[model samples]
Target: MLKKMLKYLSSLRFTIVLICLLGVMFIVGLWVPQQRLLKTVYLEWQKNTPNLVAFLDTFGLTNVYASPVTITIWALFFLNLALVLWQRWPVVKSRITVTDAKIVDPVTASGYPFRACYPILPELSGDAVFAALTKKGFTLRGTTEGFYGIKNRLAPLAFMLFHLSFFLVLLGGLVTVYTEFIGFIDLAQGESFQGELGRYNTLPIPKMPAVGSIPKVSFVVQSIEPKVTRNTVTGIDVKLTDASGSTHLVGINTPYNTDNSSFVFKHLGVAPLFVLIDPSGKEVQGAYFKLDVVKGRQDTFRLGDFLFTANFFPDYEFKDGAHTSKSMEFANPVFLITVELNGKAIAEAPIARNGSMAFNGFHLEMRDMPFWVRFYVDKQRGLSILYAGFALATIGVIWRLLFYRREIVGSVREVDGVRCLVVAGRSEYYKSLAEDEFVRLFETAVIGK
Candidate 1:
């Protein structure tokens, strides 16, 4: 039963099926969006067919990669790999032993002749022949002659290492899926925020109750520098004040570390001013907007029935009856404002030079402009297992490429009272070269010219 099980596990067909299944799973994972809400997919699909959207969401296909079914498939793949290794190990070990007499025999019982025969010298014992074969680079082992002659016996073991590396990589991936969280945070110039531990950061909505629910970790912005001529921050200087009143400074590529908190300054942007007025025509509250050079226009805040948006121009010029921007350096900043009330256009105006847009007893003005700082928070899980797996894979490739086991064996026997020498060579790679070397060594030993 054990042998049958081993045979089944080590069969090439089994591995091929496992590999094909994994390939299908990987392609599906890539094509199907991962870690997204079913409601978002359903809403998108509702634009066409609400029924299909409901069906897809009901089946949990929106985030298939992280679904329990997909994870179970991957688990089976790992099990198959483990079984394959377990089944093949005994065969590999058996092949490593060279005691099989058929491998060294000169003549078959059917009288089929072998190649390159040499007369065995009387002075040369089987031990001497084995020693000569060793000199010729054949791996030999046994207490007595005719016991064993094996070369490249460990060649099959190379697969074991390769498979182990793959297993480690899979294990690391599982760890990442279960324990690690990834998210993005957007920080504008001079703006300070205590980021959530695992949430993707975006523009904070003013007066939103969810914004208040975010945990407060004391962070202060020191400076935000331009990464390029663009509006993005090349780097940022951050001062993190811990709960114990200890402050640590961190910058780009330099992380601030605390006992429970780790911070990395990721990105920076320009914070533009957005104002909203109440129904009584008084400025109630304003929201700060972070603008990216690539993102041209941003949505506005609503006050009562009026909506206001801000368009920022680093340097503005009029070309072909439209505003054109030259650079993002804020050399000449301008705002193109549009106000709408009750779904009707109220007034359109350009508010430049710290001015206000007044229409119908309403006043909107740029109040306060502050720079924003974006930082990432992380909790380390000791050493990253994925990185360690990658390291092991690199080492395995180097080992297989540079280190090859080789062995040669020569057996001598008196054939018609003539000294005959037979040599066989084996290597993990460059077998022909090993064979040539064996021939040369045997020629030198048998027939000295």
Candidate 2:
């Protein structure tokens, strides 16, 4: 039963079917972004596909790569490839005879698709020919009747190696699906942010076997300097302590790399600090209102039954009846605000930096304009595994393509008073190329005087 199962799994037809299914699934999966949780996917899809939300969730289509069914299919693929490699290992071993082969028929090798016969010099010694083949990368073993000789002796190993790499890639992907942590958090300049899992809105939402422990991380934004030419950050300074209790400075484009986590700058924008004072001389709100111009139709917030919306300009300019900024530099930063209470318009006017407005018993003031930086945090455990797999795959490809496995079978046979050599060669694949290689060998080692 085990043998039958392996045979079925390792069959070429079965492999082709599996690959086709995976290809279709890959196309389908493109509709949903990778590494995002199903909940997030559902939310995004519901905007135009409210009815499909239930279907997507029910079928695990949102997080297709990490879905239980897809993972199982990938696990099976890995297993199948492993079994196939194991089954073919003996064939490779037989072709590369460690002991002298009883019958050497290089030209008739079943795996070698092409064969050739060549003439040789009468004075060419067997040892000399052996030396030439060895120099050209061939391992020779066996007697006349059962000899085995091959160039690129480890070519079969490359076949196995490539398959092994593919398996590791799948396993690595599986590990990433379950073990990696992806989250986004925003921090204002001089604001502190924590790295607790609870503090983050992580993606690909943990499903099975739970996740490994994540390192504790926290950092305070020190300062932000924008590049006025393009409204991008020139640099952002952040101060954090290492595990050794040493201070380190992080900046934009400079990633903070830890053992298992990485913190990289995502973006930086302005945050306007505000103070809202209610009646009875009580200070009600004193905090930064994060103004993200990239978020939606309006940048707004609410405090004490009052809603606020604003159009901001770093270098204020009114051009052609449209709100525009003269430059990214904050030479004359101002904002046009619209305030509403219970859906009734309260105020609409332009306010400069450090400006204030009072209505009834409440007072509102913009104290400072501080830039906020958002860093995307990633916790990865299988990155090394994925890279290792890629490296191995590259080695296997080079070995297989650049140095293909071929064989030359020859023994000196005395013919017509002059002792001459009759050599037959074969190629495992790339028949035409191997034929050319054999011809070169004939001219260089065999027929050359």
For 314-371, candidate 2 gives per-residue lDDT tens digits of 7788789876778766677787778889898888766777897777677778889877
TM-scores for the candidates: 0.67, 0.81
Model 1, 192: alpha-carbon shift in Å?
Answer: 4.4
Candidate 1: 10-residue stretch with minimal lDDT: 203-212
Query: By TM-score, how accurate is candidate 2?
Result: 0.81
Top candidate on lDDT is 2
RMSD of candidate 2 to true structure, Å = 4.2
Compute the lDDT of residue 96 as modeled in candidate 1: 56
Cα-based RMSD of the predictions, in order?
6.8, 4.2
Candidate 2: segments with Cα more than 4 A from true spot: 1-6, 32-41, 44-52, 102-126, 142-148, 194-198, 201-209, 226-254, 276-285, 294-297, 303-305, 326-333, 355-364, 416-418, 447-449
Q: Each candidate: what lDDT?
A: 0.59, 0.69
Q: How far is 420's C-alpha from truth in model 1 (Å)?
A: 8.0
